[model samples]
Target: MTRIKNLADLHKIKEEVQSKNRLRSSLDYPEHLVQIKVGMATCGIASGAKETMKYLNDELEQQAIDAVVTKTGCLGYCYAEPTIEVTLPGKEPVVFGYVDKAKVVEIIDVYIKRGEQVEGIIPLNFQTIDD
Candidate 1:
């Protein structure tokens, strides 16, 4: 680890560390609430999933929304990297794809807040897994 050289450097290091830790632990929120899972696989990372995940965490906190945001492996939609699945309490999960910061905000505002579904949802033509 690099040593802190001054007060500013120390604070910067602390903030960076906190951000990383926040990313890892943000999913620990109670299960009864909504859960937001973002694909963080290699393809997802190449598609800006890291920034999207961070944006979700920060925006959720800023908006005072209490939801769990976690990173997950590939959801098999490589064409739509950076896919996100939102599991609202007592409701079926909805997956959105090709997400960016704007889409992320729209998800939070429309889906999470107003319960309105936006575009980019992968069609569920067939079901293999039984709930």
Candidate 2:
């Protein structure tokens, strides 16, 4: 926890809290907002998931994009650590693998903003045990 040493610190805390609140409220209508889930398991962290998650959050804020970014356990893609699942409004979620900083920028600009697909997309696995 960070100590509130001054008015500026307090204001910063307030802004952070407000931002979190807004993000929570946005979940009420998630279908209208962009949703992102970052894998943060051991494999993911080892592959720099922390940095990827931070970049996504910061970039979204800088672009003033309304998004709900959350962290999750292993997405079952250990080979593709640091993976992210992005869901656009009214669209199916797409999971991308091996996401570095440059890939993040490309995803934001091309996929998220322009609705265009980018490389490195991991095709969703659909086979069931019952099969």
Candidate 3:
């Protein structure tokens, strides 16, 4: 890890992180945009959640898509560690498994952009208390 040498550098780092973590700050996300949650628990990390998250972040920023990208804890599918849950405005959430960089592209082009479904979905097995 690189050490901060001065206050200016520290502030710069802070700004960078805050910019990337906009989802945490925006609780009431815009209703017309998409929202994504990446599973980042221990299992998820071990199975490439970090890479998936990075890819999604870069893609969303590049495409200028109006969406909120957030990191979440485990979705209880340890076998599908690199998992992601996507929610389009006014629709039920869909959980997808084995989300690699390629899958992320499809998710954006087909799921988020075109508002169509794609493969790799992990069907909901158990209903949450909110259900």
Candidate 4:
């Protein structure tokens, strides 16, 4: 940690700390504005999921978008590694596969921001049965 010598330095440190805290808080809060789950299984990591996840995190902060980004294990879609699932408030979660940094931005701007669905969605296959 850097020592704060002046008011400006203190303020900058405060802001940085607050930003990090907010990110962690968002992850803990289930009722977050947006929840992004990046698949991080062995295959997903090999397919650049790590970079895609970082891109989403940095871009969301840069765009001042309040979102919670987390990592999950494989969704049984190894063929389409680097998959991401986005869950917006009051909407169904959509899973997109083969995500790169560019695609991640497009998902944020077009899908999350503008409410438009992008390509590369993995169709939901599981049937819900009443138990």
Off by over 4 Å in 2: 1-31, 127-131
Please provide, for model 1 over 1-131, each residue's C-alpha lDDT reduced to its tens digit, 9 standing for 90 to 100: 78778999989988997765455344453435677899999999999999999999999999998788989998889899889998776567899999999999999999989988799998755667774
Estimate the TM-score of every prediction: 0.72, 0.73, 0.74, 0.73
lDDT of 3 by residue, 8-115 (tens): 999999998776455333446443557789999999999999999999999999999877888999989999879999887667789999999999999999998898
lDDT values, one for every candidate: 0.85, 0.88, 0.86, 0.86
Cα misplacement distance, residue 53 of candidate 4 (Å): 0.6
Candidate 4 deviant stretches above 4 angstroms = 1-32, 128-131
**After superposition on all CA atoms, what RMSD does each candidate show versus the true structure?**
10.3, 9.3, 8.0, 10.3
Which should have the higher TM-score, number 3 or number 4?
Answer: 3
Candidates 1 and 4, the one with greater TM-score: 4
Candidate 4 per-residue lDDT over residues 76-123, each given as its tens digit: 888888999998766778999989988988999899999897999999
Report the poorest 10 consecutive residues by lDDT, candidate 1. Answer: 22-31
lDDT of candidate 4 vs native? 0.86
TM-score between candidate 3 and the true structure: 0.74
- Model 1 scores a TM of 0.72
- Least lDDT summed over 10 consecutive residues: which range in candidate 4? 23-32
Clash count, one per candidate: 0, 0, 0, 0
Clashes of 2: 0
lDDT, candidate 2, at 52: 99
